[model samples]
Target: MTPGSGLEQHPLLPWLALQHTRGIGPVRAAKLLEQLGPRWFLSPRLPDCGLSEAQLVQLLTPSWSVLEPLLEWQRQGPARHILSWDHPAYPELLKTLSGAPLLLFVEGDPDALSLPQLAVVGTRHPSYVGKENTRNLVTQLVDVGAAITSGLAIGVDGLGHQAALERGGVTLAVLGSGLEQCYPKRHRRLAGDIVDGGGALISECYPWEAPQAHHFPRRNRIISGLSLGVLVVEAAERSGSLITARFALEQGREVFAIPGAWQNPQAGGCNRLIQQGAKLVCEVNDILEELVAFSTAALKIHPPATEELLPYPDLLDNVGLETTAVDLIASRCQQPVQEVVTRLVELELAGWVESVPGGYVRARRS
Candidate 1:
């Protein structure tokens, strides 16, 4: 059924209750629903469904107070919606997963979930090249009629959404917190833009639930699950983006990674994924060719641009993957400390190097 259709009957309550019910997580809930069907809440067989007595009691007499905020939030606007497992608007791609969310709180076009999506995820501190790659790929993906999906994070995630919006393409932001409590506090505006741009902001958390550390890993699954595939723009050896890529693999969704230079730490995760059998993507067609159904038309392929020479080669050579002190770099280059600092700033702006806590490190190679 469509959202807001059965609000008075509170059809979503049972799903929400099942969600908050202790000991019955998404996997168990999905299995139970699979076995007993949507009307299982009223069945006499609930006692035989493997739930403990206390769990059964909690399900039978769900705390209405706990669910009021979500219900109220949905009522506040026509755009806001709550999708139960049985809802027609629940994304079909996500439903195939074993541990799919019981309920989805959506704040935008629910139909956007049904569109072909490619998830773009990466580090929070992306290199300038990483940002450029994300924007360039997203722009072309938009041209191919694919929706961009990502966590509403600061670096790559935010850039993906912004790029899609700038291209006037649909994008979805899966959140680690409730719809009301936009995490990072910085992307709240971007979240609004997603909704305003005919995209969506989605979350499985309760309306007022704060973002906890554990919430993000679970959030990653939704990002991957909702998409046809996931693209790792730039990630470290250990990153949440890798978790999303892992989920994409388990979900049977195609996984794509952009190869990065060996010396770039941010590119380490992508390189690792390529080694592990993820399709190495160099352009939009690499993805479109795999998800053939999403390709709308042939793209005008362009030749690769000539790589520019690295400015201040001597100064850059002094910087390494590990943070190198400015003084050490100056001594190595035999330049004054002030001159070294000025050139370093130019290098940083050029995306050749970045300043870190200890000093400077090489940024991603283009």
Candidate 2:
């Protein structure tokens, strides 16, 4: 049946009812489905299903008002789809999770959901090094036919998606908000680019649901659930990226972390994860080695080429890993402030040093 058909007899109505029914969460709903099968929704009597009276009433008399927006959104375009648990396009890996969403509002290619994905997640305000690491690793992961998966947040998540697109690879972005209301607002174009590049933007929330603080942590599960493994480039000791790593561990997916300088706060969670047995990722092979078994594609390792000597060696030498003030750098290089500023711009474009708040620091190279 077409999605635009009347709601009263819609095939997906029961699934929607089950999803919105009070007290019938994913876990309990899964149990009910297992015991009664898909036909349970049409059954006249639901004996031994263990649902409360209120839940049964809600399921039997669904609030069609709550589901209208979803139907309208799906009818708007062919690329858009609302996938129920039994839908062929619904991801099997995500289905294995304990609290998997009953419906996924997807925009773009639903087939991308089935691709072998490697999740790359990290801090929203990642350091310069963290940004570089995310881009380089995501690019390499895409080369090996691994689709990148990440939340569409601003920092590392955005970088991962952009890198995958730039490398001409597929990337999936799971959202904390509804598909209609892209979170962070800034990455809305990135979200569209994902679709244009043959990827997808996914959300379990209804089309109108706004982003909430709790939705993000909940969103992390799908990121890990859809992937063969998760690579955490940089995260604080208490970061959302670590939450995705924890979910990866619980889901029996490999967890990989990059070691960072001890002083770097963003690396704390990764270091801790390594101590707790997450594989330490120095190069792409570190992750590829663990996930090769999951993919049919042959592995290809591309070693990084040698670093070329950066111009303005005297000025470059003055820029340390820590944020170095432009004035301080100029003083150390014994050059005028204007000359140093011009040279620093060149250095930045050449991938030598990056301008951060208060100064410049050497860019981390792969």
Each prediction's TM-score versus the true structure = 0.77, 0.78
lDDT (Cα, tens digit) per residue for candidate 2, span 1-366: 334455567767788888888888888887887777768886655855766788778887755676677778889988999998889999989998887888898999999999889999999999998999998999888888899999999899999999999999999999999998899899999999999999999999888899999999889999999999999999999998999999899999999999998899999999999999999999988897786565645345344456676699888888999999998998899999999999999888888889899999999861
Clashing pairs in 1: none
- Model 1, range 70-169, lDDT digits (tens) per residue? 7679899899998988899999889989999988999999999988888999999999899999999999998878899999998999999999999999
In model 2, which residue pairs have backbone atoms overlapping below 3 Å? none
The C-alpha lDDT values of all candidates are 0.89, 0.88
Candidate 2 error regions (>4 Å): 1-5, 43-45, 297-366
Report the number of the highest-lDDT candidate. 1
Query: After superposition, which runs of candidate 1 have C-alpha atoms over 4 Å from their true positions?
Result: 1-9, 293-366
- Give the local distance difference test score of model 2: 0.88
